[model samples]
Target: MLQAGMHAFILALGLILPLGVQNLFVFNQGAAQHRFRQALPAVITASICDTILIGLAVLGVSVFLLKIVWIKTIFLLAGVCFLLYMGYVMWKSKPAVSEDEERIFSPKKQIVFAMSVSLLNPHAIMDTVGVIGTSSMLYSDMEKYVFTAVCMVVSWIWFTALAIIGKITGMADKSGRLLGMLNKLSAFVMWGMAILMLLSLR
Candidate 1:
């Protein structure tokens, strides 16, 4: 499990870039703070499904997965494109929603939208199934499961912390310049992740 901890550490490190900045953007938007929190249900939901898939991979599902050449290619291309689009979105995105805007934002719809975003996202697949799944190779059967669980929990903890911090710090307040800086940082990370994914494919 030592390796598992290391794996989690590394994955968490990557996440600090994209997820951290993205959370900051979400917080700033105020259009979806409550909705983002509601999205936790979806994030955890996706994490659980990913954990199951990872577990299967460690048990030799990779053999079956490997048989399909298109899967990897598809994901690689999709992930690269998705990251680029995310970069563009962050780069072009405007101000955090004001109180009046928040008043009109519906938490229920936001939660569903957040869930869809998590589910449809190619980056999530690469992170959880590709990275975390491969990391499982470093351990035994029992340890692999334990590691998967830890990784899933880490994702949940990270997102929850981001949401809570954004809400509490008033860091998303429209008046603050910090919010803009955070979004720019998010755009950079998105671009970085795109480049990294593209390189990994080659």
Candidate 2:
């Protein structure tokens, strides 16, 4: 269980650390809101969206993949290819630099926008379903449960932390150095994960 939890933690963190629409939205909200608590709507909405996606990926995707051996091989190979491609994309990606919106958003707008960014984004969905869901195949019974739980916990904690960081950093990475480093680090982690997953096929 401990190992499963740790694997889930690192994987989840690696996937989320990159700068994306979801991260930027939450970060901007945190910076725009007057107080930490004021950003709860965006934080909570994004967390809830992630929870739903992870649950579906683990429960729906993992179970189906488990039943088919041939498909499992194909899925594993495809996942490896994807992680490599994603790593390259991350390595070349430039972080978006945007000024915070001029007006304060009400909780309702925040919820709506959060839902849009969280659910409407294809890449985010792919990370949850393609990476996290397929990876959950490594364990069974209790370990799987721990893996799922840890993934969800990471999402909640990460969203909250992003908001806090946004408040402190004021949302814009003028130099892009911080986000550039994050992209590089995330790419390496993805590459390493790809290697580990490929080894499992042996």
Candidate 3:
């Protein structure tokens, strides 16, 4: 159980360390919101979505989904379009002078976007299905439970930490220049990821 837990933790940490769309969205919300509490909805929504994906992957549902080529293709195309749209929106966004001026997404909006980024993003789905799901094949029964639990825990902790980091940075940047720069970088990163996804589709 210990070994399985450790393996799950390490694997999840490695997979999540990348600056992906979901992480970027969470970080951006943390930085844009007036208070850390205001970003909780996004943080919680993203973590829950990941938990669901991880659970589905461990159960082999993702594997079945992958067996259908058209489903994968459709998901990939949708993910690319969503990423490109998000990038364009981020690129055009203006820096807010203060928290009050920042465009805060309602809880429903945050949930929708978070769900889309987690469930609709083909890369995220593949990572869960391919990496976490594959790794779970090495464990069984209680060990498998431990592995899944550890992975889910790691995800929750990592996202919380990410939001905290963003909040701290937001607090420090009174002039919002840093936030503006981050938004631009996020836009480029999203576009780059979309392009990579497109290339993979070819």
TM-score of each: 0.60, 0.65, 0.94
Return the candidate ranking by lDDT, descending: 3, 2, 1
Q: How accurate is candidate 3 locally (lDDT)?
A: 0.87
Question: How does model 2 fare in lDDT?
Answer: 0.76
Model 2 TM-score on a 0 to 1 scale: 0.65
Could you tell me how far off, in angstroms, the CA of residue 181 lies in candidate 2 after the best superposition?
18
RMSD in Å for all candidates: 4.9, 8.8, 1.4
Q: Candidate 1 clashing pairs?
A: none
Give a tens-digit lDDT track for model 2, residues 8-107: 9999999999876578668766765667898999999999999988998987754564458787667667666766765676577554444434446679
Task: Quote the positional error of residue 46 for candidate 3 in Å.
Answer: 0.9
Per-candidate clashes come to 0, 0, 0
Which candidate, 1 or 3, would have the higher lDDT against the true structure? 3
Cα lDDT listed for each candidate: 0.56, 0.76, 0.87
Candidate 3 lDDT, 51-152, residue by residue in tens:
999999999998898779898888889988888988887787755556555467667877877777787777778889999999999999999999999999
Off by over 4 Å in 3: 99-102
- Model 1: per-residue Cα lDDT over 1-202, one tens digit each: 7777667666745754465334543444342344455445434444455455555545667446545778866766765676577567666654445544543324554344344344334555545556666767778776776776776666656656655666554444646456556667767876786777677666
